[model samples]
Target: MDSSKELIKTVDLLLEISSLLMVSGANTNRVNLSIDRFASALHCNTSCFISHKTIVMTVYEDNSTLSCTRVKNIPPYAINFSIISAISKASWTAVEEDWNIDQIAKEIEAIKKQKRYPKLVVLIAVSLAGAGFCNIFSGDYINMGVAFASTFIGLLIFQLTHREGYNVYLRIFSASLIASVLASLGIVFKLGANPETALATSILFLVPGVALINSFTDFLDNNIINGLVRYTTGLMTVLAIALGLFIAMLLFQ
Candidate 1:
């Protein structure tokens, strides 16, 4: 294979890696570092830049040599730590050992397809987390149980809508609306000692806490634009949840 062509292929591969890392919830510095590290392993010079909706990467052997650039538009993806960790580890090893790109790509593909947790387990865990929120707020046992059940159903609705590829805001709004409305059932029927407790805790699953944390982390890392973008996105998510809750409250009131 010609040197230029092989280098271009490596550039394309790095582009894929960057997109995967970005969607998997890696911060800006980590994505750029991984791409540069992987490309350097293959003896190619690399530069990667990230923006709100786009990623651009370039590779060159020297200033005089033919350079290749790839640009990608990425939609947001759910955070999956298993995929992120797998790629980070693979990139580090590739940098250390200069591993074959094909093998690395295969590994990434396998990791991408793997599921770290069963859906049932995730539903149960999310339910427990919501119930935990009730406990944190000093709710009674009846309220905690209502939170548990409401969150379980809300998460189930979210999973279904998410799989259907609805718009992000719509998915969040629908999920919160369903959860809060159902949670209000405890209030209406007097099933729980505190109806307010169920409504409050049910929306815990929809909080944008992780996104806000990432936004602040990016700001600390000096990626101002990305930081602001993430913060704005998190804020919008919170608004969507609030709108959903407002609608539910109106209905149940």
Candidate 2:
């Protein structure tokens, strides 16, 4: 194929890689590194700029004489560390094996389609995490049980709302309100020594810890624009959770 065509194809592939990485919770630095690895493996150079909702990429080859630029709108974000890890490994494999574009694309597609844990298992695990937080906050067994139950039901509501295409903040708010309300039942019945602890920790599962961490990482790496975007998003999510808890308090009181 001609140099121009090859550059275009490479750019398209890079856009796909960037999109997947962005949506799968990769930090900006990680995304840039992955793009570099793939470009080097294919004997090309790339300049990729990532923002909150878009990716702009330019690919150059054959001594920078041939080039192409592409802009891709990032899809909705999801948290899938497995995809991030798989793509990180695949980038190295491409370099070591000298894999062509087709091979790399196939590997990425496979990574995209990797099966997640069963829903029931995920629910149980996340609920256990909430319960663990309650215990860490000095809650007794009763508070832990209430937290576990609230977390399970809240996460179920979150999944259902997400599947129905609800807004992200709305989904989180609903989950927080429901979870806090359920936790409050312990207080109403005097069922636990630390019912307030269960109430406080029930919504811990909704914290945007990864986003907040990535925001600081980006700032440290001099990605100021993306850093600000992520920080704002994390802050708004926190507000949404607080609003839900506030309303739950009013209703239960």
Candidate 3:
């Protein structure tokens, strides 16, 4: 009888965890199926306790009942439940408050509207200048200038295309192409003391390092389709930049 009681408590905890995950925009079908499997493991009947956007669970054991309604409110409950749900399931409880979904939505909207263009441009410029300095120390002063010019041109084109509400992929492609073209021009014109150094420095602006990192992370998290798509897109952007440089050099020569 005691073992049966423990089993019911375990099932309740699993259901509670599933509920919290659901509110946080996790895949609902996956969570629900997991909860159902947990309930089956304990040989207990389980049903999800749902509120406006919250989920709870009730468990029955030999005519006695255990309710996990202690963690209330989707966000806070998700945080708290994640912390303690790994221990003895009997201690799990839901709080008795509601999450303000509307307020959360408003906050997200405000964040999206914040000015990010100027900040991004400044960051890109600083990064390129740092790359330039590195090349300078390596005895490639011409490449340093090329790198700076390419980074600046990339930043400008990105800002213009983004402000015009072009597709994000298109903007990224355009910025990379412009940067590559500028660098190639330095090579063609024999600008500065070292064209090779300048071209190398300038090409830094066209690399999609962030996109590659994100794609790798997504792949590790089992989002293979999304990860592969993003990775391919980043690769294509790089190729587009290369293609632009090739075309520009051909025409100039």
Greater lDDT among 2 and 3 belongs to 2
Model 2 C-alpha lDDT per residue in residues 53-112, reported as the tens digit of each score:
999998887666667989999989998999999999999999999999989988988898
Pitting candidate 1 against candidate 3, the one with the higher lDDT is: 1
In Å, residue 154's CA in model 2 sits off its true spot by 0.6
Clash count, predicted structure 2: 0
TM-score of model 3 vs. true structure = 0.51
| TM-score to native of every candidate shown | 0.93, 0.97, 0.51
- Model number with the top TM-score: 2
Model 3: residues with Cα > 4 Å off, grouped in runs: 1-99, 117-139, 166-174
lDDT of 1 by residue, 83-165 (tens): 78888888888888778878777777887788768999999999999999988888888898989988998889889988898
Worst 10 residues of 1 by lDDT: 57-66
Which regions in candidate 2 have their CA more than 4 angstroms from the true location? Answer: none
Native-structure RMSD, model 2: 1.1
Per-residue accuracy of model 3 over 149-187 as CA lDDT, tens digit each: 677777678768766888755776677667767777877
Clashes of each: 0, 0, 11
RMSD of each: 1.8, 1.1, 11.7
Tell me the spans in candidate 1 whose CA falls farther than 4 Å from its real position: none
